[model samples]
Target: MATTTGEARAGTAQPASLQLPGIVLGVGLGGFVDGILLHQLLQWHHMLTSTNQDHIGVKYYNPKTVSGLEMNTVWDGIFHTVCWIAVLLGLAILYSRVTHSRRRVWTSRVLWGWVLVGWGLFNLVEGVLDHHILGIHHVYAGEGQVWWDIGFLVLGALLVAGGYLLQRSGRPFDPSAPTRREARRA
Candidate 1:
């Protein structure tokens, strides 16, 4: 089939997997944000805070006590480990999708946009399952905690929509071609 220069360029770009890699990466990184910001820094809630009713056989631990804090920390470590694994997996998938050098794809809006979507998705899934369904932990906890949970979901939805728009507008990356800097030297 005859192809225009743009079509040819786009065709050679070896279409980026816009969603999977970024979302997976975003989910992992987002988990870090939750773990670091909410769980550790702020000392708001832990993995098993509201699990008394959620899991009948689960042991309840109060965050204020040293013993309870130790258990929560352990659970947080487990959560972080899962997030780290996710990041590694995401990177592997992203590496497989790129046809040429990663220069273009790494810097492209599409990747970052999908990342935002992924982060948001993480919030939605975690918020729904842990916060709402299982009653594990709340974003703020205490008065008006539901609002905070709802806000988390809202932010996730916004990220997905915004990321979709940004990803759509991104130019098809052709990393096999020389970057502008390399082109200038040529």
Candidate 2:
């Protein structure tokens, strides 16, 4: 008679761990889009500069130094580089999984879903803090900016929720349960 231990054998495959790099990448991508398009490309406003200005007796002078422009660009570039690194790391994890021929697991999906959830949460929190609490910027800088920002939050939430649902559905991809086909042949 053959005996088997309760625990899985050493050669047994394990599910992949949650991918942190991917999560970071997703968050970084969102931040990059916001900073690049909103702050830099479109020139809506400078992120690091203060809107408030003080006036001197002889001449109206802003607190910001002339070097603020260069500083802003450098800051933006650094932010972009960090984001890109996150993206690349995420891609590396995903690609390694693909190359290894491992079965897809619910945990992997859940991990990715959480990343989206985290990103959405970050956006909502930062939006409220910066626009409402700190008054650094108006919620709606232009005619429709508020709507757009709200939409972005909503979309982020949906991505998270949808990914969770996909992982939980548990439908069989192969359409063959381990025993069903054998029973049919017998």
Candidate 3:
């Protein structure tokens, strides 16, 4: 028997376990972690912390003032809402893909690894945009804030590198491959 080109490609394709759900979860959960730890718990900054009186020209929120705090709180709520949606969307994608597939989809390392990549992507993008581009806020808003901001970028890079390595280590799922038990019986 000969395999068609489509079949050949399918046999070598990366597993779905490494894609949708993990990336979605990574972005959403990553956002939550940042928001919860930095914004709420540590009081490091808020969604619009640096927007007020800055070059952003919004002046919508200021962490130093009561009105600013209220505005920032609302923006934070909006950010959380977006993150929730990302999570829900990811779950939906994962469910749809898994349910429609004939192959077994376990919680593989590829999934976890891609998730870390997604998270790192989130961190890198968000950190660069909010902290550097828009000047919204820094990881730490006191003296030598640049150092903290740089650290955030470094962490993001590390996560991305680590995740990529982990993902690479995983073997692609071959639909035609025999299971260990099946092979043993042959």
Candidate 4:
């Protein structure tokens, strides 16, 4: 296909490496917001906690079985550390692949989709396992918490769908574009 001047300039001027790093950075920042602001800094809830129950009858269960399950700051810190690790990993992947001397290595659709899917998966899994099953935390214990969690999941699905559309829109990486050495070689 013949390249227009504008297209040529855009292709040549902007490097994929530069664009991808920001997206990865965004993922890290978002993770921080969730782990720090929502989970730890606010102390709104913990990853695991016994559900509140009201009972007038005498306790049937042994005290030892239930005593060890209380919320602790140490566990919260560990969860936050894991979140930071995930963000760093995402950043590393984006930096290595997108910033390499390759043309169109980072597609907008794919990158956005990745972020959405990843974020969504994190929420869905965490919600199901921690909030619903283990009773470690409720999906939204605080005001507007449920809405935020739902929004995160929905946004993730949308991103994945948007990425699929972008991929199908006949916008494959042009491996023969001479301006980029990697593209020219392919």
- Top candidate on TM-score is 1
List runs of model 4 lying over 4 Å from the truth: 1-31, 50-71, 98-107, 142-186
Clashing pairs in 4: 17-99, 48-136, 49-136
Q: What local distance difference test score does each model get?
A: 0.81, 0.50, 0.75, 0.50
lDDT of 4 by residue, 1-186 (tens): 244435645765323332344344444555566677665666555544334421223222221244432334546668877778767876676655543424354444435544554554555566555554554555456566557556656654664455444433433333223445545776
Per-residue CA lDDT of model 3 for 2-56, tens digit only, reads: 3343554477444455476778878898899998999999999998887653457
Query: Clash pairs of candidate 2?
Result: none
How well does candidate 1 match the true structure, expressed as C-alpha RMSD?
4.1
After superposing candidate 2 on the true structure, give the runs of residues whose Cα lies further than 4 Å from its correct spot: 1-16, 49-67, 88-99, 102-115, 133-152, 166-186
Tens-digit lDDT string for candidate 2 (1-186)? 011222213444323233354456566666677677777667664444433421222222222466766665665577677767766776666555443223443345545564565465546655665554553443335577667557656766775566545433322221122234445676
Location of the lowest summed lDDT over 10 successive residues in candidate 4 = 54-63
Q: What's the lDDT for residue 17 in model 4?
A: 34
TM, every model:
0.83, 0.50, 0.80, 0.52
lDDT of 2: 0.50
* Shift in Å, residue 5, candidate 2: 25
Model 1, stretches more than 4 Å misplaced?
A: 1-16, 53-57, 174-186
RMSD of 3: 5.2
